[model samples]
Target chain A: MWDTIIINPFINLLLWIYMMVGNFGVAIILFTTLTRVILYPLTAKQIKGAQAMQELQKNKRYLDIQEKYKGDKEKLAQEQMKLYQELKINPLSSCLPTLLQFPIIIGLYQALIQSIASAPLDLLKLTRHLYPDFLKIPDLIPLNTQFLWMELGQPERLYIPGISFGIPILTIIVVITTYISSKVIAPPPQPGANDQGAMMTKMMNIYMPILMGWLSYTLSAGLALYFVVSNVIQILQYAITGKIYWGNVFPWLKKTEIKKP
Target chain B: MKNKILTIFIVISVLAISLTSCSDMNSTATSWGGATVTDSAVYFADGMQVIALRLDNGAEIWAYPEKAAANRTFLAAPVLVGEQLIIADAGNLLTSINSRDGVTQNWQFAGAKGKYIDSPLVVGETIVAQNADNSIYALDLKGTKLWAFTAEHSFWAQPASDGQLVFAPNFDHYLYAVNLETGVLRWKTELKASLVARPTLVDGVIYVGNLNGDFFAVDSERGTILWETKVAGGVWAAPIFVDGLLYFGDQTGIVNILDAADGSVVDSINVESGIVGSGVIVTDGIVFGKENGDIITIGFDGSNLGTKTVGGSIYSNLSINGNLFVVVATKGDNPLVAFDTDVKQSWVYTTSKK
Candidate 1:
């Protein structure tokens, strides 16, 4: 069922795109762009919602509720919901679209692994799930794996003599890009905001980059490329929507301002 | 609730990422493939699909999976035994396919631990295979287990034998000698490092190298290291002994020819790319593949005969029959490329072409 709904279609789409571009790296970029196009409306709406939420946090009533219920955790939660309802704000609007993109990311990761299959076995594994129509591409047995200086199918660690430092180039790029995107997309934590959800977001903001960096370091360069492209696109979407708060994304560069109530 | 679940997922993903040791993740497609060739056909384990192709023209006869198996992927070389092909996948399912037609399953067995990582070694009628978790199973032609061998670490290399006795290299830094008939440990010798390549039996001496780039020449009968020498890099492929001269490649892409008698380095030919696949000695000269997809052929004196780039990296062993020499470019656009003595591609078989 998953195969028909997600895996097979993704694998076939990737192969078809790969056939057109004759290179897996370009194919990945094109596929990422196509997905972004499909999800643009949802992504844009979410970005706008986040912007709204950031503005809402600056409201005097919201700040008063947060300060008044600072001691009662459950009361603070109820009051926050009550205030949001009074303001006609849907807090989930910003999250659903971000959640919607996860399956696509997982699906693309699987597709890229099989499409940029470096091993014959990996390629053979791909043959099992491919849509029958894709098999008709003529002389398309070996997809070109090279993209610039990287072998898209292999891990992207660079080796230099005598240095002994393992440099994962794509991993570093993925980390920086992911951090940049999170900064653009996430609503800035209010100065002295004592909230559970806000704390979790802060944790994600910090730890997520490290985790993503590790994945990009270990996984095939093809997947890393997809991640980099995905992050860049998300960043671009935020920039276009005018939702990016530079201070929030780059916290150290700007001092946190305590609002004058 | 949604936010809570999302936070949990983010935390789990971060944990998974931190635990990952920069190795191929469990989520990625597995990375094993090689082809074994006979006079009439070439068989490949493409991941989940096992394919049979005509050796002459790279035409496809049949492909397994006909549809995808949700939990299985064929990730290694399929051992061709007589009329049937005895193949095992990473799913712990050992299956036999009829080589003539490609779709018939004769029988199957499982190891109960994990999938087999190395190609099973075929003796007269016994098939011996090792798993990634360090268990070896010996089975008869009928898929019946005769005996099982266990070690401390994983065995990634195929077992080699001198008819009466078997030699297996383990990642636990030991080479074991087992009695093929009884399945008992005949003798065992610890090495300087983890031994991964199948031991090459020359005369009666067993030559093997480890991940530490330490190569050893062991006396097969007594199970003792006769001599050990350090090479340039890790030895991933099996060593090839041609006549009196010995040749093998390291992870650094340098092929070293050692004096088979004293384990002395006679000549070293650096291919400038990592050598992940073993070298094949053809009628023309000694030919091996580098991880960068170049097939390097050299003479006895280590002169650069020629180099040709096929595609991707080469990790599988080279299969040669007559003038048709084939190696599965297990990476990149995974294709089974056959070349003749003149270093020309005869035919290429991949999933798309067939």
Candidate 2:
């Protein structure tokens, strides 16, 4: 049960590959690349649909009809539907790929947690480790949750050597990374758009980064590692797709972008 | 418009196919040897009913609601000894119902104690019931109090005996060896880790692991530590001994084998998932449940023998009779399932069905 459900097949393959490569960061990068490749078709369809919706929004007559029928909910819906039909754009076509990625991402996160062997209570029959079992080293922190002064299993807390500050440094990094990732891909708001849809989009743009950052801090470092790698990969993907991958895109500007949200 | 209908049909067809494939992917794993050679029909709490199935033919003989009412719940497995079926209820009541008629013959534990016994281990004439209040109560076959021993913490591990002394590990990081007759603590050794499952005893060596992933081999009589090995993950399930090797599943999905004599690492296999409870050893084969609600069996050479997937987590030990295994399977999204070891559709029983 634990193996079949929590230890997802994708994570297993990636971990197996990680063991062979001896680098988790590299494993995450490769895994994300493969995931993006698998989702390419869906994303392409969504991008095309978004362009069509933008094209439809350019019609002033359709906008005027919507404004006039706004008081009548049924007439407004019919007019919107008619406009969508004329433009050949599906209203929700842009959401499918993003929605489909939710379960996969969740499964990936679960797999990483299970792989790190965290939360021993919820894990089943895993008394031994898949890796090397050190007999005399339990005295110095169980399993190496630390790498380069960062506790890989814990969110980065401010440590003063003699004091327990518990300040979440990793959370800050997560917030910054998520902000940068969203800024790189977020669609620009249309001119004279309805306030409700505009507000929703604005709220999502602001809140989603904070949510991801909070999750990065609260969850295991395996997930944090995933997020960090994912953000880097997304940035790289954007650069490549935008035809700007040949040279360094202002490193100074990238740092500023990280601080946006 | 035609495309819209086609899209809807495609969506519905995809959903139907996925659901059917998911159901069809249901398979069986290595199960406990649950079928007993005895004459009395065997029954364990599955979901809502106590399924009385023939041990010989694996046929359902009778099915009854496990509880008296829809709200009543039971925690312990229904133990069939002679003519009686001993079961523990939620209100800390131990009822010995007639096996043939399933009637109330004897009821013990008058008022509400902390919580009822999680599971009872019957050794000879004495039935050792571990209460949630960290006490082990010994009851005679007639439901009379014999003696009770209190541990430093709650006792989750089942008590095992060498036909003389009862060894039990508690949450207080100590394993106590008690005299079964007088309920006297012969010796207590601090393990530095909480024991969650019963220790596997082979020959005179007691092998037990802790929540800290430390496996120890202690001398049964002297209460002396022979050796200690640290696993990567904490062990929640009891270790099983087979062919001079000890096997234990931790909260992680790794299955480790250690030398029964010196606590040396023999071999390790990752089942790609964590196990939920201790495994049942049948000769060279081991069968256990995982937290993911799957039953897995492994052979002596670290080979995957079989697997059975269930809907709920497996919380009980597998009762082995012969080639057949019996377990309290919480199948589907529902709360109860009493099925054969083969994961066959025997009957669904719940504690709330009555």
Candidate 3:
């Protein structure tokens, strides 16, 4: 079922794009851009949802109700839901798109491994998954997986004489990009009754980089490349939508104020 | 409560990512060894055992790993020398089995430090075996070490011989021509990049391709690159010489017909997917395997014969035995498959997990 819906279609699309580009690295970049494009509307909706939350905070009725039921946490939650219903706002609307993207991400991860098959066994498995439409390309088989210095099929590691044994170069890129994107996507919390949410977000920001770094270090450079590209694109998309406030990110790096100012 | 749920979700995703990445690196998918087709049966390596099945029907004749003690998977293809079938795994272990009954003849372990990554070359009295490390060992028929040679990088390409000299292509971007008798280096030629394909010798010229997509026609006597041409992709499989014409495919699925006398392109054909170590077989005409599980057959004059799509990807080492062309699918519905000369399906055999 996974193959019929996601894996097969994803693999077929990846190879089809690769056939057009003639380079695996370029193919990955194109496919990632295409995915980002498809999910753009959902991303816009998420940003709009955030904007609506800020608008609701500014409303006098919402603030009065919050103060009126401040002592009773349960009543405060019930009133907030009532207000949300009046405004025709669904809090979970933003999350629906994100939930839908999980399968696509998993499918892309699987496709990256199969598409850049270095081993004969890997190639065999890939053939079984190829769609008939992909087979129509004349020079489609044996897709060249070499991109720049690294083989897209193999893990990207650089060997230095006196530095380290084998340093995963792409893995490092993935980690750095993940960190940067997290800062942009989920900035520091505003002063509100959301201390719990703030702490959880902070913990997640720290945990994700480490986890991504380990996975990137192990998987093929092709998938690592996908993560890096996708993260950069997500950050850019947030920035373009004006949802990301640059000042909120990396507050420690900000310049100290002068007395005259 | 929502925050706690989000925390759990994030934790699960992080754990899943770590687990999936680890699974990708250490893929438990059973890698299949290249097949050898005999008159009656087709033999191939699956997991730790080598199984032989009847060519006409998909009946299992015997398997080496039927016993618990003999259960060890191999990365290298099994080479049949005389009555002994030599199979080497990724580890430094070589198990010899009798071809007739699948009995364990001999097991040689700890002789080399690295695992065998390619086919064991049988050059005269010595069976030359190259490992994943930058080392090569020459063993006698009894699996005794005769001599060993080391290069600068890992030896990925299997060593080929012109009877007197053994040509070994190394990932260090050099091709060494060593004397087979003494295991002494006679000459070496540096190429555009590291070579991953087997070098073919016909008439005094050696034709080989490097990872950089450069195909070279080297003079066998002097070990000099006479002329170099370009292919579409990396040549992971060995090229076959048929009727003064060289037939080979690259990783990009481009199969080229090169002139044997001089390095010139005759014709080029592309398959549906990358050709991972698959080459052309001159049975009936030219039969080649593709990573997309398509067996593309082309006539001698570069005419399109026909293509047969199997349930699995076909390896480069497609073996021809009598009226049957046998190839194993590393992953798919059919683990072991045979096709007739007319490109018709003969039989398909599936394997049981260990």
Q: First chain TM-score in every candidate?
A: 0.84, 0.75, 0.85
TM-score of 2: 0.50
**lDDT agreement with native, every candidate:** 0.76, 0.62, 0.73
Please list the residue runs of candidate 1 whose C-alpha ends up more than 4 Å from where it truly belongs after superposition. Answer: A1-261, B1-30
DockQ of each: 0.11, 0.04, 0.10
lDDT of 2 by residue, A8-80 (tens): 4664566656655556656666776777777777766766665566566667966798679979989888888
| Model 2 global lDDT (CA atoms, 0 to 1) | 0.62
Q: Which lDDT value does model 2 have at A124? A: 32
TM-score, cand. 3 = 0.63
In candidate 1, the residue pairs with backbone N, CA or C atoms under 3 Å apart (3 or more residues apart, or in different chains) clash, namely A118-B331, A118-B332, A119-B330, A119-B331, A120-B330, A121-B46, A121-B47, A124-B46, A125-B46, A125-B48
TM-score, every prediction: 0.59, 0.50, 0.63
Runs in model 3 deviating more than 4 A are A1-261, B2-11, B14-24, B27-33, B47-49, B63-75, B91-93, B97-105, B110-115, B269-274, B278-283, B342-344, B352-354
Candidate 2, residues B1-354: lDDT per residue as tens digits? 445445545643453343223220111111111122235666654423345655554455554453435444454457776776776543456667677776446656543343342456788898777664568888888888889898765675577888788898876778899888888999999887666767878888889887778889999999999999988677766788777888878666788888888889888878767664667665547877776777777888888887867656565566555445555554445333434444453544333443
Worst 10 residues of 1 chain A by lDDT: A252-261
| Tens digit of per-residue lDDT, candidate 3, span B1-354 | 566857656755766664475343443252445777765566777555677777678688887767524325555667887878887776667767787788767656458765566778997678888875578888888888888888876675677888998888876678888888878889999876766677887777788887657888888889988888888876777778888888888777788889877779999887657766554365567788777877788788877788777757665477786677876666677766778777778877776522
Model 1: per-residue Cα lDDT at residue A168? 86
- Stretches of candidate 2 off by over 4 Å are A1-261, B1-39, B47-50, B56-71, B282-284, B306-312, B331-354
Fill in the DockQ of model 2: 0.04
Which model scores highest in TM-score?
A: 3
